[model samples]
Target: MKYYQKALYDEMTSFYLITCDDEGDKLGRIRSLIGGLVRKARQVIGQEGDDKVRIHQLLQLFYGDWGFHCDPEHYFEAENLYLAYVLETHSGMPVSLGALLLYLADSLKLPLYPVNFPTQLILRAEVDNEVAFIDPWNGHYLSQAHLQKLYEGAFGFGAEISSEELERADVNTLLNRFRQLAKNALIRENRNDAAYRYIASLLRYHPEDPYEIRDRGLVLAQMGCYQAAAEDLQYFVDQCPQDPTSFLLTAQLAELKDHFSELH
Candidate 1:
């Protein structure tokens, strides 16, 4: 495997292993699953040298035969962010699906790379030295116009999809984006303990991130750990004293202190 691919795989697997105990066995199963996918792709993809043809065949195997697609109704569910659950259910949000699709494309020797597109995860494909976009939610190809429409839809119609925005996401960038989505999903569902664990798992990558510290504090507060929450919020306030949200968190910090005193 190339260095970039190996690094990405390691980061993805390690992130998942944070939650589960049976690491080796689970990794083995995931490898077996990828192997099965590769075998199936070979059977259908044939000896095609054309990148586009191979991409199409791989898409057929994945979305058509494997039934992997986004479940819009349950898009925000925490299960949609994990690879194991995504593989089993064949349904995931764009980030999870895009990561798996990117890995599959690489295994099949297709020139697919992750695009950390705003509000949507996508893939950038290079075929015959020409760059194009593919929506990992479905196999549909994306034109620049379509990309503009998506950007406008997400951020309102004025700003365009900049060249920088279409640049390929590096391993850490991709992993962090996916992790953030998973954490947000957990928080939205009021799964405070799970959110806390998820944040702890990701903290190693960004030990001193004030945003994460503040979020962890909020999650702790939700779980009734007022003292810990107070400490965290205080850290955030200290780190970012001028931030607008710091004012609100300062108020919350007082309440947490009050609660801590009551419990004491």
Candidate 2:
């Protein structure tokens, strides 16, 4: 997580290097780590087979021998989202685990990418010249027919799945998912300051994201930064004038500013 310098935090930028444009220390370290994993996976899979066989072997090595799966013990743990910790523990949430194995696949020359599943993170890979939607968290290959059922289970029983649901996720989308994971956990645990930091990072990448701006304002208010909170809330209200919560946000912004005035 950005190579700690006397700071102890679970929130990290180590995974952020994967989507980074420029070559820097964090990106280089990430490359080195992924390279090692790819080399290890190659040793397990060997080079005697075609792409299909290699992909199968790669899955077996990661999901079987490596025993990498979702962290059933601690589902919301921040360490589960940290790449280095996930690699070491061999357990993580869907996005973290999926991205790690996906990186290895990319390094190994396998045509694999992440799918922006509406409910959860998954992977898409080419196997036998066909697309195999993978539930990387469990190492299961999901078929088209079964996708609807999985979607129903995740979203709701009556919900319908469409072809457009299988869209690819971009780098920023992936990073935003990572940030939200930590943000949700921090807010849930009442760590408002840390949550504010996480949401601030998210807003930096997604400046116009209304919900993030709204939530960041709420987080700041909880952390006693009333003026800053009021500013963010006002910005959200102004930028998203038609927002469903605009009236509520206006009320909150006024209250936040009043608190700031009283304190000052």
Candidate 3:
């Protein structure tokens, strides 16, 4: 079972949460596969000098040898977040694949890191006094001009990208992005039960998130978990007490409380 860590959203743990059930019945197999992959990666870099650790080598290993690539068919499917699915099938959306690749890079002591790009995940590392960026989804170099083109392509001509958008993202941002991917997929498929679980996971890592608190409460109520719904709504109301939406949420929480009391 993935012992729920309420502190920070860990990469491996988050993968476990998405891919496996709470019991994680299949986690052992997943871990074994990951161990073997890392071992192979380690062997691939055996006794090589730091300069030899180039992005193309990584591309060859992950894409050519390991065969990891984007799942174009199910680009945003919630199942792509499952690490086991990615390992076995070698396909996922950018964030999942990027996150896993970044994690593996870190494990191997590579300087690779995740970057913040609008609606897309990317990787970057400092090499020889210059920063190198890679698009994990396709293993292509991500230059500034390319990033601008990608931005405008995804978000019309008026939308532009700058240094602000290219900053390196932290763990919390990665967690939110990961949760958002699954949350969006679940909500799209009308899987409120699973969506609520992901919302709960988001709150664990970011308890002060007012939007998530409000959304989670709404989802909880939809799933007939009245008490939890009320608590989450109340938390949201407390966090953003000045927000006009909180007043409406307050009324809803009051109604939910009354319903909960009668059921006791």
Q: What are the runs in model 1 whose C-alpha is more than 4 Å off?
A: 1-10, 21-25, 46-48
- Where does candidate 2 have its weakest 10-residue lDDT segment? 1-10
lDDT of 2 by residue, 138-202 (tens): 88888877888878888889788776668656656555666667777667677675566566666
TM-score of 2: 0.76
Ordered by lDDT, highest first, the candidates read: 1, 3, 2
| Residue pairs clashing, model 2 | none
Q: Which pairs clash inside model 3? A: none
Higher-scoring candidate on lDDT, 1 or 3: 1
RMSD to the true structure for each prediction, in A, is 2.5, 6.7, 5.5
lDDT of 3 by residue, 106-216 (tens): 666566767768768887876676788888888878788888888998899868887766766765766666666666677776678778766776678778888898888
Give stretches of model 3 more than 4 Å off.
Answer: 1-9, 50-53, 204-208, 221-264
Which predicted model would earn the best lDDT?
1
Question: TM per model?
Answer: 0.89, 0.76, 0.76
lDDT (Cα, tens digit) per residue for candidate 1, span 118-208 = 8787888888878988888887889999899889999997878789999878667777776777677778888887688778876777899
